[model samples]
Target: LPSQVSDAYEKILSRSKDQSWTRIILQIILAATRPLTLDEANVALALAIRKNEPESHSKLKLELWLGKNFKSTVMNLCGLFVSVYDSKLSFIHQTAREFLTDSEPEGTWKGSFNMAQSHHPLLQSCIFYLSFPDIDVFHPPFDLIDDIDGRIKSYGSTEYPFLVYAAKNWPLHFVSQNAADANAFRIQARTLCSATGHQRDVWAPYYFEEYPNSTFDDWKVWPDLTLASYLGLYEAVEDILSKEKPNVNLATEIGRTPLASAITQGHESVVKLLLDNGANMKEQENDGRPPLSLAVWIGQEAVVEVLLKEGANIDAQDRYGWTALSLAARSGQEAAVELLLNNGADIEAKDRFGMTPLSLAACSGQEAVVKLLLKKGADIEAQDFEGQTPLSLAAGYGKWANLWTMLRGFVAIVKLLLEEGAAMETQDHSGQTPLSLATEKGHTAIIELLLNKGKESKLSLSQSISA
Candidate 1:
């Protein structure tokens, strides 16, 4: 029964190619008499017509078959059959018939539009254009018509074909095969426009609508502006800024200024443009850290020099009260630290916790920064709030290399402190003198350096310990 039922339809449709409509009709009757449902017979007949059989009266025959039942199934099949043949009238008629047949009076024929609108706007647009003729399908729904119109108006001129296709056939717009092809076309069109600077009006509209509230200060719009600035289209950015300037002080949602964004992204031209336009160089983000700090933190020496030349505050402190010099020094940025110090940044500036730049450099084992800070008059004996001096910080943290380097470069600092009547045996808040710290951290070289001084003083343990 399954073979007869299945093969019967195939056999009946196969006759259409040979112009065997009469035989097809006879077979349909015989198959129906075999206890198949009327819908089954109609499906068989519809399949026969769908094969593009060379029959002269194929449409007429399909019409006759559909008329027998005229229910939802028949209308559904008719809609599908018409879609395959590009028969718009037949598709609409069947869809309308299904809508009228449903018990719900408010049901309207929305074969593909309904399905397309449920998807992403891009995909929905693709499907609607491919499956339907135009946006006129849902006429009675004035609001839907307006919605579709608004969406269509948003696309570029190059996207007209796709919009047309989407507004028409919801199924075709959503159909993967057709939708991909249409998307390819849209991408190609956009590429051509970008390449040739063509249809600026079309491209400008979408950009303006999307970024109406954007500004030069908004890091979010920085990329777009960077691109435009790279292209030398100062006018484009000017037009946008004329509409509204973003909060000039507003840090990026991710904690960067538009200027920082441009610099970090390597948009030199955009950075120059922004700087010329008065983009703030002293604006701090990521916990109140300035742009110069970020450049130094990321080892961007060139950006640091630029900011410094533009009058960026070299001594600006972050939330931790760490200055640009401290950050650069701790990160082993010798050149950046040198630049900051040359620009009047204090080498001995302490952070919120009272850890000076030299102490931070020594703590991080940045020998070069330690040497530079020492050479620039950093008070080698300066103590933190914890009473830990630079040497004590390096020794306590087990930074032997940094301690050795600091001692070698500033050995006279030790001699000077001793000569100036400094307390070599003074203990920090932790009850550890610089010598004790060096001993605890096992800095043999530093220990030797300190012991030689201790021996030279010849003050016995009682005098040295009491001092």
Candidate 2:
């Protein structure tokens, strides 16, 4: 017999011939990279279901379709295998996802669901949905939603669920399309650009909210070549560069060049193209991370190597005085740490907080990195701005949300720290010792390891520190 999960998915897909709402909802959710809120799903379904139909003629039809009972309908149809988590609808199990996406040799019509190319249609929908009336009010630059008269004057329709989703997810869908498809897709995308705010204004609020790291107000000000370069759209990048001269060093609002963006994304071809076209390798964002530092921070080994080969400053520091080596060690990126060390990185380099690379690696439970640092003769008793040693930092980690995962790795980390001659009695600015911090967090494994290491540990009088 087939598994229970497979049976459930088969049953759902089989209902597609019946043209049920369940199939439509599932298609939308499965195609989406991000989870859809219930409100987003309801509004989106209205547009998705009427895709091939003529435009609407009545408010009553629209109202009925976007009814309050949409959630109940989904629950009734697929509650066994689907549920909302954190306000976004998603499949209940990994088996359900695998069954839906992966096809068999003798697949039926329902199993032939085209998931890889799913984003193409969704991209079309987003462009169409944003083209509707009253979307400008949501754009905020127009300030049309500020007053009652402005709302009435500007808005023809104001149900915002579909608008909210379309505004945030258009780029996600576009990026997934192939070069030929993406280039053709830009026809509709560029059509919207002629509208007020150059099309970006409609999506700006949601974009800022979703991508808080984005430093620019509107990427339209930057050439399409710049964005294509950042997204690793190799064909599009070549096409754009062929048409235009090299703007490889062109920057966005916060001084983030195309090279920095590509390095941050680990886009190798794009980085090489920008580099070949004379892009500056040392460009930093407004937040102060140079291209090399960004690569190391995210553990992009190949990109880091390329930057290093291209003569990037191996020891570049951000505004916070954090070096690439320190960032790699603290993030537990072993390959990056090894590469940096092999290239002559400062193993004990301290940041503004006075926390060395070794201390951070041990505190973050990076066993391999800690061993590597110790082998390189990193200071065992180095302290931070708060005078917390590597042992104290490891003990402080008990207060983290991932206590179990950290605790599991940290037991070993603590053993290494002790063996490497880490000072257990070292106190932080709060006057608490490493032993006191571990005891407070109830890390019996680390506590036992500390005691068994044959060191006379002492606790401060108050013992208020924790990981």
Candidate 3:
């Protein structure tokens, strides 16, 4: 044994100096045994009784022996002394039993145990019980999943393994580990697609192959393309499309077509190739949403440009009567809104709710789009069906950045509205004035800007207050 062990033994022996030398030697020998068997425990108890040793001292010595040799000894003891011993000893025995019964060859086990002190009352535990110090039981290569019947089972199921206890959890582990393994990568990609209905793009790169003539219509070939596209494998997508005439128009069960998926994620190059290779630019999904709407909604300006160049209908509306320009404005895509407007999109187009694109731009605090629409001769005083103007909508959102952007040209528009006999005090059905809405939203700068432009209207109020 090391010096520390020898010193500890010497210290224990010194504490019992009043005892006979023979009894001390016997106690030390019993404590040094590799595993405390049942017979050994009996012998130890008998010796302590014969020597008239204190019960507490005898138990402490037994605990010290068990602490050092519990792994080897407890398994052989068949959970005998646990109920007879103190709570600490019982806990050690219980944990040892769990490890022996649940741990796999990989030395990691994922299962739950019932304990009085646990928060869940019944808590799941992943225990790494190992003899080698170099082995990390916490992060095993594969997690051992125990059956509902409490039997330890190998990872042979079609479902992916979950380290219900590992620090990095299962999904992240699967993602990181398989990210470089070709076969594992493909499996993970397919599994993710199946689980999430292939709506996400993270698995695209793993599914698509880097070869010509690889048609994704084949289930096997499709998995490859799905992985390639989801993983952002640009070269893989190009190579696959080059070799195989994959069905670029293939839509998932949820109606997420490959082009829509790529464009929504800002994969400009993949989108370009898909468009160039006859991917339907106007393919409306089951939801009646075209790919251009997704590009505009996600603020992918480059993808929007590519789609527009491919002659995608600039005025196509979704089921909600939302055009790409409406989506761009609502999502704060200034450039996309400009592109759509310049492409002859109707600036005053209203959605299903009768809210115009300008109203949406104003509500979202998109000052640039508001200015662009105004310059394009969009009616500044145009009201939604509820009689809410763009300025009123802008005041409601209280976006200072958007308010500032709008203010750069707002004076001229306010003047035009006033000259056009637009009601300066016009209220929505809520009876809220534009100034009241701006103040309620804390748009102090917008309130100031509006006050300066509406000084004539406020003059009578100012004179009344002075009187």
Candidate 4:
């Protein structure tokens, strides 16, 4: 039911070399987590060669994925063994897929296609491909997405295929178990790291976009021992730590220690290993954001519990004066907020901007954090550096903010503030009331609610005047 089983098809694939390439084509189809595009397959087969000499690379680039006869060559070699769908390599039928992966003959499948071992070849191909002298010039301006995409696309056709594929997939190949590929990958990683800022910038964007989820490891900006720990590379972490009198607290350029990176990655083993080997749990990174703060910043509760148990400074603030509770509350991390509150974090603690955790929680529309902080006696009318209260903060008045940005839960926070008897007529140093801020932000719901509260407060004031 798959392909027409013609004798001509059988005759062509029966050739010994054709059969070998056929096996590789099938393997590429079977083991791939995503579709293996025609161009990707062509590049893969080209690099399947094992030579590492500079002369070998020069020759390979000439015969790369864009080789003149590349299309017909792959077609003749594949025969009916594989199919092309949407320009991606694949088998024709479900039966073909099963036959390849079932291992019915028990280990007779193509040696090159074994999912466990195939990654090494891909990894080698990537490192070799990226090693091109030209890659040294492909630098994105910053870590921003548009800059990255634009810079990665700057390579010309011959270079673009290898450039995109290598940039996109190398991390998977790197993490694949065949990591000890003659120590080549380690040297490649070191080489990339050792390159000028321009070269490293080209590769780092892909790592950020795909590798691990968005975490604070900061591998894109700085791939250090800390990043290795975060990626759960035990050998790499141990290798870094085993050096003579290693500074266990060494932070990345972003101020993240190995422990902070591991925590962000949620690798408990790496976290424990760092701590057992002397990672300072209290060490803060980029903005005085301590390891404990980093834990809650990403909402890793397991790491949070560990840091708390290890005696992390519960109230430690970043350079902006944000504490663990402040970050969790702002990000709507209820579990972390609860954990910090239970551990005696200062619920009403103010940052340098005089914005308390409650203030941030309300502004971020995190109702639970707002409620939790209020339950813990957060100063409802506390003023920030802008002389704006938590209610004003809920109305979205940050010290550096010029515009009244509408936030979620504005109505809920407004109601809660009114219920708590927070002064409705209170104004910031700019003389704008909470109602004025809400009106400016065009938050009609919150504006209506606050107007009614204003009328009630006026009525109470008139009654007191008569009394």
lDDT of 4 by residue, 1-467 (tens): 22343333344446536566566555555545566667777776676555662343456667765643666677777656567777777666565555444443333342224565656666666767766655554544544644444555555234556567676666556666364663556645545543244445666555564433343125555445665665665555655667534677877666767687788877766687788898887677766778888888887889888878877899988888898899998999988888899999988788888888888887777877788778888888888888888787676443323233334556677788778888878889999888788767676667777888888878998999999
List candidate 3 stretches off by more than 4 Å: 1-223, 232-235, 238-244, 285-288, 398-423, 436-453, 458-467
Q: Which scores better on TM-score, 1 or 4?
A: 4
Which digits, one per residue and each the tens of the lDDT, describe model 2 over residues 277-358?
A: 7887777888788888988887678998888888888888898878899899889898898898889888778888898998
Question: Which candidate would rank higher by TM-score, 2 or 4?
Answer: 4
TM-score of each: 0.45, 0.62, 0.46, 0.64
lDDT string, candidate 1, 1-467, tens digits: 13343333334333343334323333332222122234333434444344332232233334444533534433343323222122111222333323323333331221212322222233322322222222221112324442434554444223342223222222222232233343533432222123233222223333233333443123223344433433333334344344445354445465656676656534444455567777778776667877777777777777677777777888888899988898988888888887888889987789988999888887776777777777788887788899987766655564444555465443433334344444577678989997887677676656676788788777676687898
Alpha-carbon runs more than 4 Å astray in model 1: 1-223, 226-250, 266-268, 399-423, 456-467
Best by lDDT: 2
**Candidate 1 vs candidate 3, TM-score winner:** 3
Which candidate number has the best TM-score? 4
In terms of lDDT, which candidate is stronger, 1 or 2?
Answer: 2
Each candidate's lDDT (Cα)? 0.51, 0.68, 0.51, 0.67
RMSD, each candidate, Å?
21.1, 9.0, 19.5, 7.5
* Per-residue lDDT of 182 in model 3: 25
Clashing pairs in 4: 255-285, 284-290
| Shift of residue 231 alpha carbon in model 2, Å | 5.9
lDDT of 3 by residue, 110-226 (tens): 122112111110011101100112222221121321121122112211111211112112122222222233232333323343323432222222122122133222323344454
